[model samples]
Target: MRKEVPLLITILTAFIVILAFFLTPLAQTQQILLRWYAIIGGFAMFVGVWNLLKKHVFQVSRGKNTFYSLVLVLGFFMTFAFGIYSIVKYKDAFYINSPFMFNFNYVLAPLQSTMFSLLAFFMASAAFRAFRIRRLEAALLLFAASIVMLGRVPAGYALWHKLPLIAEWIMKIPSMAVQRGIGIGITLGAVGMSLRIILGIERPYLR
Candidate 1:
């Protein structure tokens, strides 16, 4: 009974949503569904906050990595508090402009930037390791990569104007074609999976 009821609701909702998308007259129904989604999403945020609080409180109480746990809890609550304060008090400001902003901008921003910057070094190392002059295909790939790198920079343009033209062609033509093909494939796959779930053919979510 429990499984059947949920499945019935899912099928009904999916049908309504798809029908609303196709039928222009049912736009209001779609809007209502979107509002319901927002309400549910807001409630889910509260649940997430509760879960985060529970985990950190447990860690702090047990004295297991208590310092880091405290930092996590403090950061989370501080951000939440600032968000509330900004909404209630300074309603017109761009951001909260609280301690949260300072911490995020100064400390977290630099750390996050540094972490992402390491990716360039990792990519370089990986490329160096993978790059071998053993085959024609490898040579072509290397040549293309070198041209792309040179074309994007001022020094490369100064060295040769053809580099920029080649880079532009690669970026505009082949890159766009590949991107569009992947996007279409992904959209089709998503639609197929969604239909399967709506039809109750996929029920992994059901116990």
Candidate 2:
């Protein structure tokens, strides 16, 4: 009964959302449903936080990567504490120079940026293998990638006068055209998936 109820609700909601586009009167109904969706999503965030804390605390108790797990649990509590303090002290208006803001901007923000900066090196290594000139297509891709990568820098301009112009033309024309084609493909796939879900053929959430 529980599964059947959810499946029926899913089909009804999907149909209503689809109908809202052609039937103007259903648009307000769609907006109300969307707001309910937002409310449910807010609650879902707490569920996720609970799950994360449970997993990390379990790891800490089991002594599996205890240091990292303990750090995660401690960090979560410290962040939550400062965040609540900031909210109460500032009356829902967090200032730029607040303790929570300082921790986020200086500590967490730099850590995140450094992590992403390290990832760029790994990406470059992977790109080098993918951009190998083993075939005509690969060679062309390598050339295009080289031009695009270089043209954004001042050194590329110093190297050749027309290199940046060629790069700009390639990006604005061929790259944009390819992106539009991919977007259309993605839109079609999304429509197909939506139809499958509405028809009860793709019951992924049930699993």
In terms of TM-score, the best-performing candidate is 2
> How much lDDT does each candidate structure score?
0.85, 0.91
**Per-candidate RMSD vs. true structure?**
3.1, 2.1
lDDT of 2 by residue, 124-151 (tens): 9988888875988888898998998788
The positional error of residue 21 in candidate 1, measured at the CA in angstroms, is 2.0
What is the number of backbone collisions in each predicted candidate, taken in the order shown? Answer: 0, 0
Residue 119's C-alpha lDDT in candidate 1? 100
TM-score of each prediction: 0.80, 0.88
Instruction: Give me the runs in candidate 2 sitting further than 4 Å from their true place.
Output: none
